[model samples]
Target: MRNILIIGATRGLGHSLALQYAKKGMVVYATARYSTPQTPSHGIHWIANVDVSHEGAGRRIAAHWEEETKIDLVVISATYFASETFEDLHWDKEVAMYKTVAIGPVFLIQHLVHSGLLKKNSRIVLVGSENGSIGLRHESGGAGNYGGHGSKAALNMVGKLLSIDLKPKEIPVAIVHTGYLRKENKEGFFEHGGVVKPDEAATALREWLESFDMSKTGEFWAVRGPADIKTAEVVLGPLDTLPTPLQLPW
Candidate 1:
């Protein structure tokens, strides 16, 4: 069975991925910012307080596994979003977003690689966004989300650099656009226009992962294709002309 580690598994896409992988009978190690539940699902193991924004988070995760446990996959899906405009930008929120989305993954992966937790053929998937694409900024229509968009763009660069470093070890690094997800609030759950549910995103992401290989390392992809990206037509082209599991521009 594959040994998979999913960072930020307490909720959203990471939670769905953990459940899906555990159902497949894989050894799933999931990290949460809080205490692990006493009753975790079968095949799922929880690592508590592995906040990606913390510098030591990676080392903490690496220490959890035994020497013989070679992690086949590591998916870092932790993210922080704080809406901002030029006049109302919050400094603390921006710092947190940068740490979670861009800086933290680099140090964490470095620690894992140095500690031998990630071995040859192991894949690293960085959950990013289409908003990260500099080319897609044209679709923003002057709407501002400075921290979220900027940090993800930084993440894409980080993933590319890590891919170059890990190439000698035959480790493939991929950055993915998980999709525009729906939001749940006290007002009741609501879809954000063309947003997808977390379960649907997880399924598509899993299918995309199955086909990922070294040849495609350092590339950015949209697992949900053009279906959930409202700006796909405006930015890239018509949806009908695009392929499923679209290869995204950097």
Candidate 2:
């Protein structure tokens, strides 16, 4: 079985992805922030106290991996979101969010590569959002969420740089938007807002990566196409004419 490492697997898309991968009998290693792995048990091997926000997170993660095991896929799914308007911006929250969303993944991947856990065929997926897209932001016309949107954009840039740096090793690095997800069904949340449950979004992302290769490295994509994007038609022309997996603009 192939070895897969998923960071931030305690909840949301990360949790769903870990469970699904474990159920498929892949050698799944997952990380959690708690001193004890608080994630629901589903045969996933846990790496506890791995908070991606800290600079030491990568080193902590590296210590847990066995020398004999080389990871086939590394999914950096750890994310922090803090909604902020100019009037009420929280400094601490924004800093934490930026570190988790953009800076932390760098150190984690740096450690993984330095530890020789990744081989040529290994791929890295940085979970980004369409909210990162400046073009979309202009068309969609929503204000606020500065930290959330800004950090994701930073993540895309970080992923691009990583792809360039790792090109010699042929490790394909992709930045992707999973979807607008609903962790739980809230009132009218599942009605028509294009919000999918975590499981469904995870599956869509998994399928999208089947054909992703080195040629597409450093590219940003919406794993489920442009259907869920608020301004897809305005930016990408006609929605029905677009492909299932859409390449996003940075």
Candidate 3:
């Protein structure tokens, strides 16, 4: 059975992926930022208090799986998003976003690899956003989102650099745009027609991972294809013309 570790697996796409993988009988390890539940979900091994924003988070996760020879896949899906316009920018929020989205994954992956948790042929997937793409930024709607977009762009760079460092070990790193997701609010959930459910995003992400290999390392991809990207037409042309699991520009 495959040994899969998903960071930030408590909710969103990470939660969906962990549940689905466990249901398929894979040995799933999931991280939580808080204490583990008294009765955890079946088939999932929970690593509690593993906050991706901190450097020690990866070391804690690595210690739990020291006996395992190798981890087949590791996905860093932890993210922090704080809405900000130029006028309403918050320094604290931006720093938090940068720590979680860009800086944390680097140290976490380093710890995993150095600790022998991730070996040759292992895959590392960093969950990024389409908004991170510099090439796709057009005047249509490229304003605002200072922290979210900027940090994700930093994440893409970090992932690419990691791929280069790990290439010798045959570890392929992929940065991906999962999908435009719906936001859960106090009132309820709200989303546009193009926004996909977390489960849908998880399913698509798994499919994309199946085809990912060393040759595709250090590349960015849109797992939900180009249809859900609102600005795809303005930057890359008509969405209908693009293929599913499209290769994204940095």
Candidate 4:
């Protein structure tokens, strides 16, 4: 079975992915700040207290994978979006926002690559958002308190560059824009008038992972439905000024 490493697995989409993969008989290394769920025993190894932004976090994760088997799949699901207004926060908090949102994933990828934990055919999936699409403006005009829109936009470009780098090595990288989920109820975004459910999002991610093909490396897909029906080029604008991955001030 494939060995899967899922970050942010304590709750939300990450939690659902961890449980689903474990049920499919894969060895899942689930990581999160808090404790993972303990209801069913499905051969899931919960790795807690993981802070991806820390310097040694990647090394620690790599070592853990070495202890058993290399990770075939890496799912980055952890993210932070504080409701802090630009006026209320200091520079330090701003840096922290980018750190948790962008830098953490970049560092983790670098660590995994350098640690020799990822196999040639290994797949890395970045959970991204439509908010990142520079050209794609939400009907709501992005009045949300969290910085999710900008952060997700930055992640999409990172995936593009990563795909270009990993393709020659036969490894594929992808970013999935898991539509807005109802944070509380974990249901469809439209059903609740643009609120998405974590469980539903997780289910979509699992389906995508199951059908992944190396040829589709560096591609971005909508997590809600028929990928072909929705074109990213139409949604995401040019990436001229997009933030570089891991370059955040944090």
On lDDT, the stronger of 1 and 4 is 1
Error of 2 at 15 (Å): 0.9
- lDDT for predicted candidate 4 compared with the true structure: 0.69
Q: Candidate 1 vs candidate 2: which has greater lDDT?
A: 1
lDDT of 2 by residue, 81-114 (tens): 8778879988899888899999999988988888
Residue-level lDDT for 58 in candidate 1:
84
Note the Cα lDDT for every prediction shown. 0.89, 0.86, 0.90, 0.69
Q: Over the stretch 93-189, how does candidate 1's per-residue lDDT look in tens digits?
A: 9999999999999999999999888879999999999889887667455658899989999999999999999999999999999898778777866
TM-score of each: 0.95, 0.93, 0.95, 0.79
Better of 2 and 4 by lDDT: 2
For each predicted model, how many residue pairs clash, with residues at least 3 apart or on different chains?
Answer: 0, 0, 0, 8
Off by over 4 Å in 1: 185-188
Question: Stretches of candidate 3 above 4 Å error?
Answer: 37-39, 185-189
Better of 2 and 3 by TM-score: 3
- How does model 2 fare in lDDT? 0.86
| lDDT of model 2 at position 185 | 47
Ranking by TM-score: 3, 1, 2, 4
